[model samples]
Target: LDAFLDAEDVLKVEGRLSRSSFPNSFKHPTVIPPGHHVTNLIIAHYHETVKHQGKGFTINEIRSDGYWICGLSRAVATHIRHCVTCRRVRRPVESQRMSDLPVERAEPTRPFTYCGMECFGPFWTKQGRKQEKRYGLLLTCFCSRAIHIEMLEDLSTDTFINGLICFIALRGAELDMNRLNVFLTEKQCDFVMNAPHASHAGGVWERQIRTVRSVLNATLLLSPDHCATMAIVNSRPLTADALDGHNRLEPLTPNHLITMKSTPALPPPGKFEREDLYGRKRWRQVQYLTEQFGSRWKREYLHSITTRQCWHSTKRNLQVGDIVM
Candidate 1:
């Protein structure tokens, strides 16, 4: 009944239009409201249905179907193109703009390198009601991509120098330390001028710090533990690839992803014969061991052990007149 009545009303309107000699062009199977055109209808339908439904359709897709007409005047097309919402939602088709300066290629002999240092943490320690902060240091050699990390209670001048000394002593053996022509850092005053070596200022290390922070955050989000964080970081391809630039590099962690032959263990020192126990003989043995094993031994063992002792000796030791707080 309601449908029949609606049909009857539409027919009556159609008949009245015919008798009144209304424009034949306006007589269509469906009569849209006054002031509403096909374009408006299509635009409304696109926004309400297609865009709202989370499906993306191009302007051409809308026009190819009868839903939108392709024969719209240039003015109309331009207006639609200028629509702020549509412009915002559209994916840009043009390539990004290039810098005004010409791109310079790296020198044939020079290749990119990366280095990083760890700033120690547990950033705060509670004492009574107060907290103490500590930070660790890390440095990396770009060409070799070898890394050195240190822990320090503060970023004082002396601490910086000491940390850097340990770093250089451990990792600088392979390089002609004189060949370290340039150092790049993220605008850190300590890292920039802590040493007399060449240094360059840039945000590269800062950006790297952010990336590391993100990695750590994501890792901790899954499992908040040092082991888990390190595992996740070491599992990444970038970590191994970054470290491989060093000549004598080994995996940064205890676990190895690939199997390989193991090197033979060094023989223990032979018993000191009377002749061998002489000062010159002992001195030669010490020199030989230092030359052969100093770098690796420092990296693997001495660094951590000595750092703890150094901290204790410097700060924990009390003097005769020292005020014990």
Candidate 2:
């Protein structure tokens, strides 16, 4: 910390490295006072010199070129906070705190009593010799976090209604929607659809769709039925920490709530490989898909839902005059 005024009437650090071969500029870095206009100019110049990188890069550039500002880290942070170019490049969009859960989500009702629905896919399946496209319809129970998936032949209204009927047949008929729309006008049942361009509004079911789609993409090679995919999605745990009580016996999965069981079905008795997916035996292909789905579900999806990934804390509301990208 040796510092003194040089002959030029500028403060500079005196260094022990004077005996070393470093340039005079590095050996005796010029000291720039914090909160001064010159300090701002120098930091701004180097900040630009680094192509407007983060503070660490800016600080490194300043020191490597032999200028030392008092409280350099804080000074650089303040500068970047107000730098219009930096703000434009790195400022995060405003986000409000997550709202309180509605009664449907908060209450512990029967599985599928209060539910959300979404559709995904056109997954290719080999039916005999011809390859056919199949879609999946997902129904998520808000309260129990149980999911029921139905396979759809196409996106036609009839196909959707048929899927809904299958879901009702298995999961029961007393279903309620957050924003009800009557997909089955004849059944006098209500359904809900998010408005165009506002996918976030359908977050509950949309999230399930993403998780289910990822599992399908990874597990399906060609000919596995959507029912197998259904079992995989339904088998996911309901809570972040699925273990409970001292026993920690089995994680509480949606299957437990829906069917009072943890496992969807006993995985067929042996290790399966990628080659099994394309093997001539259909049972092996299905078993391979199940085995692949289970490993990945445990590795990825189970851990993924355990934590809130984003919008973790709230930010101030956007003001009228605020500009955002």
Expressed as tens digits, the lDDT of each residue in 109-208 for candidate 2 is: 5668788887788888778888898888888887556677888889987888788888888777767732224445545555555698777667888888
Q: How many Å off is the CA of 149 in candidate 1?
A: 1.1
Scored by lDDT, model 1 comes in at 0.37
Worst 10 residues of 2 by lDDT: 177-186
Error of 2 at 256 (Å): 7.3
RMSD of 1: 19.8
TM-score, cand. 1 vs. native? 0.29
- Candidate that scores best on TM-score: 2
Clashing pairs in 1: 117-138, 117-139, 118-138, 119-136, 120-135, 120-136
Among residues 3 or more apart in sequence or in different chains, the pairs in candidate 2 whose N, CA or C atoms overlap within 3 Å are: 181-191
